[model samples]
Target: MEKIFYYFLIDVPRAMTIWAVLMVLAAAATVGLIMRPRHSGTGTADLAAEPGGPGPDGATPVGAEPALRAEEQRRRALASRALELHRYAEEVTVAAERSAVTAQRRRDEWLTAQEEAESAWQAYEAADVAARRVAAAAVLPEPRTPRTPAEYADRERYLHRAAMAACTRKELSVLQLSDALAHRNGWDPRRHPVEQEIVLRRTVRDSLFAAHRAATERERAAWRDAEVAAEAARSLREEAFAATAKAEEFRRWLPSSPSAGSTDGTAGGANGRVRPAVRWRAARAG
Candidate 1:
């Protein structure tokens, strides 16, 4: 019985030593495997090459692990949205600046039109004064030389005729004189030059006034467009801020819940990560 006990004790130590050595070898192999470089056909490589799963480049590859892929997708989607909103804000800002410039230009044009209208009115007034003076000069009483000599009477008649004929100058064309004589819409036979001159001056004045009104209307429209563009740019900037804030939430790793049905509505990934199951739009309701 003593020899049997001694043999058992010796065998047990050797078996224990062998088991410990095997455990050490297993641990070393596990560490080596963990530190090894990956290539094709390896599990990690296969996961990276999976089709239709989101890669680090913001593309989804196929056959990727569902939970990890979903986490990546959530992060990428948030980042993409943030970048897109930032770019949109920039574009809107540029548009707002352009609209403001257009409004200023319209305002300048409106002012110029006002000046032109004033000048045109002045020209019309001057023309009207001259035409009235000529008309008045032609309306003198006929000379009475009945008791005078024949030469004196003829001279008096010639003087009256020349006064009436002086209103229409040689510069006036035959067609213009005929139109003035014919008494058209706004013409009068007694005031030939006044008829032609007043019509032309009034037409120019009316045209300038109309142009001023149109310029004013265009200025108002441009201002409205500028205001609208500024409002849009402001709103987009706020949205961009909100989007950036929301994207920042996904920058850190979110721990997964061990519960099968989490009350917080967080979805657990296979690698102890989680994604918010609910939409992140609660802050933008206003």
Candidate 2:
């Protein structure tokens, strides 16, 4: 019983170690097989030499050189086709990126152009207003030939006649428009006849309004011109007064005239005679 127990402890351990070592070896062998290069056949020239193994007449065996060459060519063709596909994919990607960049640039350019256009329009409007103001403020020349009261009366009469002519034309237009509208009920109000008549009436009315507005604008423009002329005349008078004052100041510094006792430049001195004085000339500007 003692010997049997000893064998169970020691021999059982040894047997287990042997089984473990066998399992490890088997695992290593399986891994090597999986990693190894595979082949269709180990050395099977009989299958490659011909479709059917060994001819019926039992001729000598042919080599498998043709089959080997065909397989090598197929592999090279497959590699070339894969490389071409990769190059095509790269080209497509580059084209897409370039298109995206170009579109973004164009969008920015368009936005910039729109901004420039708007700014230019605003500047133009500002310039126009400034020009108008400058024109309104510009000085007017004094009349070379003054107009007589009879000429002024004649001008007023002409303006009155023009106004009367405009009124007459407006009355004629209104009469024509009324006559056209009188036929409005002859056809459906929504139909072309009535609609056309309504459109014509609106057109006549708009024309009359436009004419009235134009006449008002003309009168306003004339009044503005008159105001500008008046302002210019006042400015001219002020400038004349300033010139006269400046001339008087210059006269005080001039040498004494022949009638004066002294020709000297200075004012009265201790000797009771004017000292040498500076002579001034009137400088006219062109």
Which residue pairs show collisions in model 2?
A: 264-276, 264-277, 265-275, 265-276, 265-277, 266-275, 266-276, 266-277
Candidate 1 lowest-lDDT run of ten = 277-286
Candidate 1, superposed: residue stretches over 4 Å from native: 1-66, 142-286
Top TM-score: which candidate number? 1
lDDT of each residue in 1-286, candidate 1, tens digit only: 9999999999999999999999999999999999998675566555566674456565555455686557556654654454445444455545555555655666566566556556655655655565566556555654443444665545444433433343343223345344444545454333333333445444334444554566556656655665665565566556655654545464334444443434344555566444455443322211
Question: Count of backbone clashes for each model?
Answer: 8, 8
The C-alpha lDDT values of all candidates are 0.52, 0.46
Looking at candidate 2, what is the lDDT of residue 17? Answer: 100
Angstrom error of the Cα, residue 87, model 1: value is 2.1
Candidate 2 error regions (>4 Å): 1-62, 139-286
TM-scores for all candidates: the values are 0.36, 0.28
* TM-score of model 1 vs. true structure: 0.36
